[model samples]
Target: SATLRIELSRPSSSEFTFDERVNRSHCSVSVTNMSQQSLAALVIAYSILKRRRKSEQKRSCWVKPWIMQQSEFSACSMLAKELRIEDPLQFRNFVRMSSQQLQLMVELLGPIIGKKDTKFRTAISVHDRVMVTLRFLASGDSYNSLQYLFRIPTCTIGSKGTIVQKYEVFPDTREEWQRHAEAFNVQWNFPHCLGALDGKHIVIQAPANGGSHYFNYKGTHSIVLLGVANANYQFTYIDVRCNGRVSDGGVFQNCSLYDLLENGSASLPDHEPLPGRNMPVPHFFVADDAFAIRSYILKPYPFRDQPAPNRIFNYKLSRARRIVENAFGIMANKFRVLRKPINLSADITANIVLAVCALHNFLLSTRDSRENYLTPGVADSEHPETHEIIPGNWREDSTSGNSFFSLERGKRDNYTTSQRDVREEFKEYFMTPSGEVAWQYRHIV
Candidate 1:
């Protein structure tokens, strides 16, 4: 009788045979007919060959040659370095921010947008990512254009919620609301005013099979950016993604902000009398005729058949509402993305608008950027002594094909009697010594 067993170990195979019938003899056999060390060497040689083939294949397909040289030849690397070292003004124009401001933003956003480097390749720097996004916004160029310029693949920038929430803050406290009101009173001579509200139509490509949901009266597809701007031209409250077909009043009625204001939960200050007036008035937002008049909101009297006092009130409201218009103007001027029909999806376009609004506030936070970004005559300015209006550069392009269009006026009958009374009170106040500005009469005339 014979028993056979086979064992394989360390790339070598051995067979053992035992015979018990005659003398219990034992014998050993080698399965490969080669020395154990030789078999082990052959196995090791085969593994090395296979690994080499895989390594060569990976090297051939890993990344494009131009992409690999991004550190040295990329537009972001070359142009940004030269502009930063040579001409800071051009650098500001290039990135829509100063070097210092860009560095500060990078530091703020680094930890959140930062990526861990892997063994195969290094992660993209946060600064580069920001620069790419800003360039896209500043030029309104397509992702393909940006990829060629920045030497990066086409991708959307992320982590915008932090910046949007931090900078574009609504006035939620009494003090904050009073701060805006005080600014309006001092600058625009409108008291008890929290902000200037309006809607801007941002053109976009027609959605696939969307029909008339995004179609506007202008024969284009658009989404509305409803914003309330403070006296200093910073957005305090913004509602985006509203359908263009809806009237401004309809959009306002549908927004959560309208509910907040109507329910007295928007954290507005208590009703207070105008300066030198006895009537207690609620703090309200000033809007255009496109918006419906409410107890907490005010619009101008009709354009036709207005008396002197009503005209004066309308002029004053127009002056205050100019801030919101200027806010949109300056933003569109600086970030040209809004100037053209954004070709991205509606969701991405909304995110882009929110991001630009946040950056608009961020750039205004510092004195240098504020002054440089919105230099004299860049935005509508009031003469300190004469109180004359100096039209901004944005006005030069008001009729340009790229600029935004005004919202269609809503139904005039939508206002209530009490809302009309509020307007009348303002009309009466504007003609009085308390709320009247000396130049208001000149403008009205």
Candidate 2:
């Protein structure tokens, strides 16, 4: 039998019913040969019915009631809490500027940090959050206390957390910190200085074993050392190896900075060569009598008689040296760890120190004006003067040596007793500037 193929035409309404009945047999045989118009009409009808069913299902599954209920829930409510913004514009402005500064640091350290994970992909930029966290730490509030202020997680506040690790991109090297200081210097005003130097202790939970070494004379355990700060009080150098038993002088001597100074390799910023001199030896740091005297390291002059000019020079130097002391004070007050005893691993303690110093610099650099974070009952005006004997010049007696100070003997005993004698001698020398102020001497005693 042959497969028959036929065509059928159907018209609208009553005409289609009559045609279908009349051609029922033919229509059954020719269904496969229907016209393109008939096929198109069938597809259109199916699509319309599908859309209607989908619309009805969507209407039945509406979530407006649940959404409204959620909105009414106290936890889901959005409340705009009023906050005191010192300068809403200031932080944004600083972010724009600081981002450029941070980029420069990345460029200079490109070879080292470029290959490592940058880790800056959070909603808050890593650098901005780090800077903010540091400011909070330096300002000296408890970690739990800063939740409302910074809107950061409590876990992110300390050195061991995600926030700090993400931001600690640079290596803990003197050169690296120096580069950071250079960047900070560009943004802040600190003349004749690369960075400020101070020491701080980071408190920790007591170690389970061999923890006695961390204990210090203050009846607490700590790691004592020196930190280099920019004029804005940011750390450019941090040495945290010295045991808490060591003095600042001991820490400096053990640090690579002392070796750099001794070998004449350390470079000072903006230092000009002496007139008619081939290479300018960098100017040394300003320290109390704790450090050795080199042409580079400047210390206050020991008290001497008859010269008001020298005394004036010493006074100015002492005033300048106070920047470091004030820097240390600020560090201690801002991070209660320094005020309290530290009890952590030496490495962690060191990291805490660096982190705190970095934060101090950040706060000092960002703040409109720098002020000491003084303790209660401690007046800003009451900072005591630190007296240092000019090393290599303290003489036991005028007749015994051409110079008054004995550097050789002082070095042996760690300069402990000798420091006392030098202070006394300076007091005596100052009392008799052309004439005796006997009553003033009484006041000093």
RMSD (Cα, Å) for all candidates, in order, is 11.2, 19.8
**What are the Cα lDDT values of the candidates?**
0.79, 0.44
Put down candidate 1 lDDT per residue, 1-445, tens digits, no spaces: 2323232222212333222221222233334556667667666755665564445342335667777677788877899999999999999998889999999988888877777778877777888877888888888888888877887777434332333426866877889899999999997889889999888888888899889998887888888889999988999988886988886668788777899988989889888767777777788999877787788888877756788888888888888999998998898889888888888667877888888898999988878889878967879988887688888888777543533787888777566766666677778888888778777777766
User: What does candidate 2's lDDT look like per residue over 1-445, in tens digits?
Assistant: 2233333433555555643543332222334555677667656655665564445342333333433243233111222111113443343232222333444433433443222334432233343344444444434446665544455445544542322222223224555445644543243221133444445444444456845765554455556657654444444566667765555455678787778767755654444432333333343355556565555555565545635535644554454455565566555544544544334466765666666655455445433423322323321232234333222211111321211111111142233444444333333433444323322322232
Off by over 4 Å in 2: 1-81, 84-206, 229-234, 269-282, 303-307, 333-337, 342-345, 366-445
**Candidate closest to the true structure, highest TM-score:** 1
Best by lDDT: 1
- How many pairs of residues collide in each model? 0, 13
Model 2 TM-score relative to the real fold:
0.45
lDDT of 2 at 224: 61
Supply candidate 1's per-residue lDDT for 438. 74
